[model samples]
Target chain A: MTTLTETRVDEMSFTSPKPKRRIPWGSIVSAILLSLGAVVMIAPFMWIIQAAFGETARAFVLPPRWLPANPSLENFESVFEQVPYGMFMFNSVKIAVIVTLGQLITCSTAAYAFARLEFRGKNVLFMLLISALMIPGQVTLVPLFIVMRQLGLYNTHAALILPALINPFGVFLLRQFFMTIPKDLEDAARVDGANVFTIYWRIILPLSGPILTTLAILTFVTMWNSYFLPLIMINDPELQVLTVGLTLLRGQYGAGALGPIAAALAMAIVPVLVVFLMLQKYIIKSIVSTGIKG
Target chain B: MSEQIMTVRSLKRREAMAAYAFILPTLLGFLVFVVGPMLASFALSLFDWNLLTPPEYVGLANWEKLFSDARVGGIYVNTLRLSLMVVFSNMTFGLLFAILLDSKLPVLIRNFFRISYFFPYVVSAVAVSLIWTFLFNRDLGPLNYYLGLLGVDSRINWLNSSQWSPLAIVIADVWKNVGFYILVFLGGMQAISRDFYEAAEVDGANTWQKFRNITLPLLSPTILFLLVISIIGALQIFEQPQILTSGGPGDATRTIVLYIYEQGFKFFDMGYAATLAISLFAIILVLTIIQFRLSRRWVFYQ
Candidate 1:
């Protein structure tokens, strides 16, 4: 009789009203912590934005203003007057565009060959190329400088463009992506009498839009932001890119005036930030997948 | 049969030729830029040359100077110390944020934090460093002002003082870079099987226990990958310190790469710079090998 009564009680409990959902304190706390961290992550950019538009004198005041009390474009005008900011931007764009397009063509062709075509010593060649990734650019910095000078390419944009035209990492990434593509598409194209180049140019390139965009964005950003090579290779102010130009601006005005320095930095950073925000999902996914940038 | 075989051979030959043509550009670049320079760097290390004069054979003098150079030794030590601090802070915060994001938060909120954290990384280091210089200003900067509000009266000489300069570099570097680690770590954590967690729960394991056993053991491979890359990158750090402190208030933040640049460009000592580059390569090579060897003990492949 006692066992039967216990069974009835258990059944009643099963059919009883569901208990109220407990508050998720753990999740709430995690969210709060993450939000705080996010602020710290973006605080510097905020500081730069406000300082860029504020009066130079007000920029350094203690308990800094969160927003410019009276925003002005005077700092940007000073930046232009102080440096050839326009030339710097143009040079940066030209080099970055050329490198990005050049890499797309070169990397895709090589990746196609490695992924689809059979050639002698292919494995050995691929391995040799991949090994270049391990050698730091510093190792070649001295010798490459000499080579550039000897070739009379020093102090020219070509010095930056030529070496960056072919990245081993890009080849590796595209090759991996190419291999995942179904072989049937290429086989079909071949059956229709398409040549190797035709197949790669038409079918493979079309299928590779996403990865190509990823690579283009990466190459563009890298080339745009590249400082070390340009700093060493090009000394002429006329040929200077934004990164090296900003340093010069800093040297002149960084101490007493935060406004002009901040303005130049804002100009350099805004384009990249806009691109990043627009395509963040792809950027994040690509970084996670490639895991090679470092 | 003979005709058919001939056609087959001709077709194979054509394919091979096409393949060679396809790879020719990259192959040429690889030879001239990568292979040629690597050999030339070592050869250049054996000679002395400034841009103004003809090269002279110095045998192993540059290498000998490397061992005796007091500044080089301290710079290496500084590089290693800064690298350790940056790597530790980056990895810790990276894993912490990844775990936090892994919680059952709304997707919209998670995305917000993700984008905010990663914003700094995509910007130019030069630009990022410039922004940091303002914030790290000793007297009127916001950091010190905020600290003052918290009851600290003394201003921290973030960029000017030797004691705080390295820490400033680490902070700026981690702020820009920790997001990369977070994304990588989050990817690694998501790649882990949910079945492991479910099984642990059935076994009556607590949250800490589950993380300690299932999450960590499974996350070991990712940990090792990030570790090796972070160390390598940290060792080669240049832009932040170069822009922030210019290697400092007396070489307090001088890194190997910066030193190499100064020697090669500023001082026009190409041979010594080449020697330093070679030493850095060897150090990185050995350290990477050691890490991999040591990883065998703790890295769980699954």
Candidate 2:
């Protein structure tokens, strides 16, 4: 009688048994599927890196070897010897840096005015700026190429640097970032007799480190990888940046030096990889912050 | 109040000056580079000018040639087909993969996959094209080797077939770029509130039902944005086709941009090229307008 009473008591405490801790089937399946995807996505890059240090003929071997036994830096040596590799690297670095700096200053100034200053036609002007963003870069390429030719900037680093420096994306992105700051900070600066220029330079600019970092990375990557503008603007072989340089290298290899090209490709990725590693935090932040607005 | 008004007026003038100063570089650059060239391309389009000689005004001849040019239609069709295939497939798969990634998984594993997918977006186009070329090679390529193992004919010239040529190009293009759209979709998915899912779960809704009722509605705006931008971008497709095929085995893969590049640079037919540019510009504009108009019926924003 006592045992029967205890069983009834246990039954009373138990409502519906929590659904047998459902096998985390979803997580396991997704993990497996995504891992496969990761492999597929990363394979080509790996292949290229292998091919870069690979022998021209052997690089094309069926069953594709993931590891090259005789990986050498000869391809890199050839890239330096056969082409203006150093000059190209220097051009890319110099142009990207100067353009990034130029964008930071010019875009920040314009963004500050749009975000803070109240002026007549401010809305209209800002609208025009934003609308310009929709105009495809290709539409402007031919005209810009001609303009560069006329200005004697054709086949020069300036042609690459100048057009990129005045990016609408930079202006727009910086303005959005600047708007996030509380107005009270600027007002406080103003009441302290800070001029608009002084306020922007001293207070507003300093507070915008993260966004500025984001913009810097964006501008750097865009300019660094840009091909068409440089293709049209720079005709001289020596003036070629890495994109054109790589193209030239591809042509020179003529289907034989896959390993060297792969190695060269691996070399090509170093700057981008460096930049990515350095500012990955800001990159994620910028992308995430934009999603909230969306 | 009077003193504030005076300060406001001075500030307005100061702001105007600052606007000019701030916009000076951009406007000057725009005028010199973009606006100035746009006018020039228009004027150049009316002229029979090679780089070697002064431009001779040829009126409607360039446009006339463009309409009747045997190759023009082929180029247009190739470009349109490629763009449509890429835009549709990229969006479809990008959304699917994003959904998969957003499912409950280990944080480290998920982020690793996310970064891996995004790797292609950062790599050079030339490298990607070269890599695909090797993979698609008939005799030595892994693709044929696999086909042979499956008892299928291994002699297929993947990039040589006029019909399959465009498909091959499209596949490569999609593989390289789907990650970018995936990132966009993932961002959209994360923005959706968990409460919606919780509510659905409480209602005994299945995953598909929850996705249809809740996820798709919330994600539509991002989808619309991606759709329009992708359409616009795909229309100007150049690098991959240019490098991989050079429009291949005849003009099978020649895109409008490639056509323009050929006309403007290779043949130095600036007028003809400019005419091609204007046509491309019109098509892109129309597509964008259509997307904007269509957004009203489908796109849901909260």
Candidate 3:
């Protein structure tokens, strides 16, 4: 069963278990090097935390204090006071939730149809959708903004949420996953008198826990971290997502207001960070799947 | 016989209808947001409209202006430089990180390094830019501060200077995106069977030789895949530079999309923005075609 978790690694020519009789210099070196790289990768988060709580609020500081001289929650407090940080997070969460949920529903159904159903123009329609995967969102940015204006979705979360609901990548990913499902299962369901929709909801979805989880986590991450859409679609602070709000905060507080912006950055990053930490396995699995097939 | 055929045809039609019903939501959205807007973007490129006045047909005037605009050249140059720098740096570091992560470590430790490295990639660009802005602080920026410890006389400001701003943004862009490449490379690495290494070892192949002859050859497909994606994505890079330098110190960090945003929204040159958008699309499309054409020579798939 080529479930999404299947790594699809080919028959290796190098699987001999090395005799670790000596110092194992290679492993040690790799471990040390990897740790250092991870530190560099993670150093920014540490700085963000320290700066969020640091007493120093300037943009340019010499002999930068990696450890804070005096740590405080003042920056976090000020972030809330200065901008509606809470509202931005809430708005972001709301839109992300809707988009993720909507994508799961719409994309799953479409993927199921694409993968399993036989229709006259199935190949043609699938080709159309796949061709769109290459088209950059910026190609349609100005026109999309105008269309949003025409639909009265301008400055509304719908502008962010609606376009997000039908991502080609999401559809493509799920369709690929669905195509991997065995025909025997559907045959079994038909033998039990389950209709197409019933089989989809009951058997397919339930059986697709791994791929669905992968899709959900990925969709949420993309939606949460999305910047360009919200930056363009909504102008109001109340409606703007966290990414756009933090940017606007830069404009408002100036780059010099480092402490509060870090605090805001910390706040903005927490939700997605939490999800990532909790569901990282699925996330990694999704990437592996995409890498092999992409 | 005719009635029986009609019954079967009607049943097939019912199945097709059910399929369409399932796909309708996505199809409608694709029409409205993706396809329709793309068509409209093309149309808008032909005319001058500021969203207030009725669109006046300029008949290729916008395209003419796009080619003639001096800033367009500068913008493309800056964009190409940034994209090439970021994509190359990200791929190299990503391959390094992937190699490290793929080595024989405790599975838990490997997972930790893998997850932590990708933390920045998951964070929003605005937030990443914010954190980096603090880290880039001239007086107390951690980077210069570290350099100071190395006795490098380290008072450096990256954001404001036109000379350094592009590289600064490139660093942050690489940081933001390198995690993705690492994931891709690691995935590609994992997909390579250990049999190749075993064969290489039997042949007494050195580490670099094994990697080049076996691993690198096999990994070319992934590299080629990433080449396409990273370049296409690099072309549309807007948010990072926008937040980092705001095209700073005089158009130094201004990428193509950033320029598009400026033209369409800030300058209300919607037609010009649309033209740039189409130009950007054409460039990406042409480049993608070229990459595919060239891939056959280098990319190896098993």
Candidate 4:
């Protein structure tokens, strides 16, 4: 009755047709428009890759080279030689990994409590947590900067890592996932005299694999690409992450160095794209589920 | 019975303690990072304070300056105009793409195009900005390169010209973000039930009629959600303008966020910056509330 692919799009909510009919002209028109849209959407990226491989900064010369005339690895080579690109990558990976782990643990626990465990003021507290979503991070930047400065956290990775570990959306996402699980299992665990922590660690966490992994990916990508916070907090060149470091290459290296900068840019973009490709389904599901419900 | 009651009370208290333990990290984080800063920001906005020196009690002086500042008005208008353009194009095209991809086309063909479209979203903003910066180059940029092929004689340095800088920012930002919006729209499209379409088909409803009567009504909620978010996100446009344009070309690309950044970081006018931030925050808050109120009328949950 079911297959893996079928389960993948459980929300498709459409049934297969019995026989083929004439090509829907209306659908065809829409498809052409969509394909055109896809082209427009994707062209910039294609152009970037093309330009990155060009032998010179003259890649942008009129009758703009759509395809690289003499593609070379010179840019890639120079990217490594000129800047501490590797160090920036390491910092990004380090911050992303630690922040992802922290958020997974913290948000899971909080979500479990809100979804299953009832306490005095639970509704009010959960509201407080979700309400944070409405407020933009820009609103917090100035004050957070002051607080971080007071705590001697300016120009430090802790400023970036710590704040990221407590995102409200993760908690909300995990809670929604938790609510969908059957309650009978929790009751059984309670009857066995398992404490809340034990029940959560063993029963709840095991069942929440899909949502947890989803949260992890979202957290990792978001933290990895975070620019503004890193921009404001870590001013020291040494403390800069991938985005900040890459930005410096543009300003300092000048237009002549476009090849190397483009190479580095390609390198910076590749990892996230790789991760996205691997987990496209989960990412799509996570966003769709949360956004539609909200 | 009395003994059992006492045991149950003890159990409830123990459960409460566990709940607190589980929630402590996130709660404390909220208080420290979110609530604390919000209060501090409000206070900072009232006083003429730079980090290096003690703050003077300026009262509403910063707020007053924000209202009187010509630069503030200019930034607001530019940001608003750019936001509207982004929101319009993103939603209009995103929904259309979702509907097309949801057709009976080969799954591989559909998915390949979808992936191709989304390829740009995963790239870093800095990277996208760099790529576009090259394209917007006056002499060597491919935009002019292509325009040259079209028989246009004069070449415009898109980002260097006041009239074009803001438009350039919009084009760059939309290119980077359109994929994410497409995915959002596609997700919503897939979630619609087949029964409605089937019913419409049986009733001799053509594609247009079916879409107008069934799909459009059902998809309104998703559209509304996207619209509100787009409006909010568009209003806060920063990175593209900051990186690509540097809010330049005579400040034509200066958004509200950029203005705040210039004041706070570059000029060290934290007080004035806070005032700008508060103004920005209030506008966003009002817009969000208005959207939320309006949703009840048109955002069909079912």
Candidate 5:
């Protein structure tokens, strides 16, 4: 009877489940499905890289190998020879840097004022900024082109840089980020006789590194990859950024010169990709923090 | 006390001045870049001007031409069709993928998918279009090769057919943007309270019911916001169609932005281009306002 009771206790007691041996069916299904989707998402990137380096032409009879049989630097060399590739890269870097720096100054200052300072017509001004944010860039395209031409900035990098520096989006984003900073920090700084600009410069800014870095990277990427503005503004091949140059090159070369163009495209994407990878934390963090208001 | 009051008043004056100074850079840019250009665009719409010739005032003639033009209807239809396809599909797929990613997956696998999807958003549209061209090319495109292997007709022209061209462009555009919408929805999903789900589970609610009641209701604001953003952005889409089809074999993918661009640059009809721009701007504004008004019925606020 005691042995029977012991056996009943053994049957009743729970055994620790073997997590490793038991297949994680939920995770397995998700992985397989998402992996399929990931191929769809990432295949184009691999296509460009292969096109840049590989000579595997498309064929209906057989699928070309995924990896290159004979990868070489010839396509890149050809790209360099055809366009002012180096100059285009320089112009892109220059415009992106200038615009990023300009946005930082303008956005931060305007955001600080909007966030911390009390002024006449503050709400109205903020409302105006919001309205302007809704105005499509195309609506302003022709007039901005006219204005830039009038100011003799057409076909120049400044044409691309100046019109863009007034990003209401940046101001709006920074203002939201700035609003989250504790008012006490500024008040404390003020007690030490810090002025508004001084406090914004010394205290608010240092505390806003994540958002600011995020904005800077975004601005840089936007400017780097900008097509519409550059396409309209700069016609001179010498002043062309990567987007304008690549389009012009492709139009001229068509399908025959895929290799060089692919190389150029690959080169064009790398910097933004690198920055995105390195500082990805800030990208997600900034959006998560500010998306509610947005 | 009198001296202190005097100093306080002076300090208030100084503060206002500092505020204005702080805002000056943005204000100047706003006037010179944003407001001034908008005013100029409106003014330009009233006149006939080409870069070669001086501007001539035509009052509402350009406006009349735009509204009454036969091409505008077809163009609008194409644009609306393309945009709605992109907006709806991107939202559905983005939300779907984000939900999947939010499931019980390994952190590494989840992060990989997130980056892989968002990769396109950062790259240039022109570059993206070039890749699409190669993939869609009839002679050597992998799309055809893969389709043939799947026992389908292999010699399809993806970007040329009127029926398929716009859809092709839409696919590319949606692929380009879905990652961004995923980011937005994922953020919204993360912000929701898990307590509601727990309570529902305790009350014997099934997964579907819980999602329909709790997740759907809670995510409405983000949905509405994404809708507005997508509509506005899709309305302005130029580069994809421009790069892919140059507005098509025969205006199959001709959008309003392309129309504006063609009139302004290719035809050098700045006046009409400006008019078309104003019309588009009006359409966008009205649509956005309508969306905002419509949001009240469904969009939940905390």
Candidate 6:
């Protein structure tokens, strides 16, 4: 009877074969639609790249060429010749670097205080900082412009850099990250007689490599792409950043100079694209976590 | 033991002082830049003073003008229209893309799609707008060229016509910003537990029913957040219209911020501009509060 039962079980197992693999039609459709959407998303940049490298006259022609027939560097040369494109690029880099560094220092310190240390009015101070986020920059634009001019900062990079150095959002982001860090390490340092600044610099900042990098990239990109503030504050062509400078270039040349304009745009976009591609994981994560625009 | 206690107390005091020192820069900046300027702008609204002239007390003159200003009325309408279009398209497309991305696909292809979608967000608005101008060009732009091939014969004056210019601004703004909404929504959707979907499947729920019952409620908070921010951002749009149309075809796309800039800088009506700025601030504040209050009805915390 035992031999018969064993044979029956074996037969049952053998009779029931594995299921056949079915084609994932849903997934296939999704992939195709997604791929098409992705092409549409990047199509503008593709057009710009084609125009930037292609002949100037071909930019407006019917049945626009997706690929440059004879690529050349003349449009790029024209961008520099037409305006101080290099100066604008340099100004953008300088201002972005200064503002990013300044925000990291100021925001990190403030965040440490808010997260780790206790003091009088701590909650009130934090509330004040957060409230400022709701106040649109336009509310301050008129007075800030007046202040900048009064302080001899008009038409200067300092006007652009000074106001952005201490972002409330940055402070809030850093504070949240700092609070997530375990207190045991900090307590150990305190037992060893480490001072507040010492602990912040050595313990908190070093452990905060990821958040700090995120904030740095966010601030850098914001400053690099800032247009309105620079447009209002700086009247001098020499002081203008890339965004304002590109507009000036367009204003001077109008639609007739599409090639040079495209070249300048390519120049402006390439550095940002390179930075973005390299650190995209962190950038996307930061945007998701903070809800801050890049 | 008393001496040791005193030493600890002193150490705590020192720590507090150190904390104060750490926050001083931000505190000072806040006071100088944000707080001071806000107060100054409010005060400046009461006076008429261009940069080159002595101040004259306006005494609600600008306020009265703002109410009666016909152009201001039209400009506000245009601004609202543009914002509505942009917010609708952005949210719809953003949610669609996020849902599409949530489907079964290789991780590699997912990243590629995400990066491609988000690439334009990082680029300068001015540069992108400049390129858009070319694309919107009447006769030679690829947009019209493609349309012609698809059986349309006439060229659309996208930047020149009042009708088309606002639509063009909406397109450019949505193209640049929808990526952000997509990522945020994707993040929110991914955070939903898979167990719920599996349970729904066990109950014989179809894909749409599962999504409608499980995903929508869970993602409500994210949707609310995006709606509030997108409305605020859309309302204050400056670059796309300023670069594309320059509020052209007669104040068609002149946003509140653009109008403020023009009043303050172009015409140098400083007092009027301050009043406009205050109105914008009030509008945003009210909208944000209303959104939060309304979110209580629909937004699910979990």
lDDT of 1 by residue, A1-294 (tens): 999999999988998887899998888888788988998988888888888998866777767877998899889999899888999999999999999999999999999999999989999999999989889887788888988898899999999999998899999999999999999999998899999999999999999999998898788878887899999999898899999999999777856579999888888888888888888999887776777554
Residue pair clashes in candidate 5: none
Candidate 5 lDDT over residue span B1-302, tens digit each: 99999998888888889989988888888998899989988899899999888889999999899879999888988999888998889998988888878787678867888888877877778778877877777767788888889999887887888878888888888777778888888888888999998999999999789889998899999899888888888888888888888888788899999999999999999999998998898999899899989998988965
For candidate 4, the share of real interface contacts preserved is 0.60
Task: Rank candidates by TM-score, best first.
Answer: 1, 6, 5, 3, 2, 4
List DockQ, one per candidate, in order: 0.72, 0.45, 0.54, 0.45, 0.52, 0.73
As for TM-score, the candidate ahead, 4 or 6, is 6
Output the number of the lDDT-best candidate.
1
Model 2 Cα shift for residue B64 (angstroms): 1.3
Candidate 3 ranges with C-alpha deviation above 4 Å: A1-28, A56-62, A291-294, B1-6
Q: Say which candidate scores most in DockQ.
A: 6
Candidate 4 C-alpha lDDT tens digits along A136-251: 78877877888899999999999998888798989998998899989899899889988999989999999989889888867776777788899999987767899888888876
Over B166-280, each residue of candidate 1 has an lDDT whose tens digit, in order, gives 9999999988888999999999999999999999899999989999998899999999999999999899999999999999879899999999999999999999999999999
Angstrom error of the Cα, residue B260, model 5: value is 0.6
Q: What is the lDDT of candidate 4?
A: 0.81
Kindly provide the TM-score of model 1 when superposed on the true structure, using C-alpha atoms.
0.96
Off by over 4 Å in 6: A1-25
User: What lDDT does each candidate get?
Assistant: 0.90, 0.78, 0.83, 0.81, 0.83, 0.89
Q: Is the docking of candidate 5 incorrect, acceptable, medium or high quality?
A: medium
Q: Kindly report the docking quality category of candidate 2.
A: acceptable
In candidate 6, what are the lDDT values of residues B92-205, reduced to their tens digit? 999998999988778998899999988888888888789899989997898888888889865999999987998899888878888898889999999999999999999999
lDDT of 3 at B28: 97
DockQ, 0 to 1 scale, candidate 2 = 0.45
lDDT of 3 by residue, A23-90 (tens): 97888888888888888888888777777777635423554556677778888888888888789989
Model 4: runs farther than 4 Å from truth?
Answer: A1-35, A292-294, B151-154, B202-204
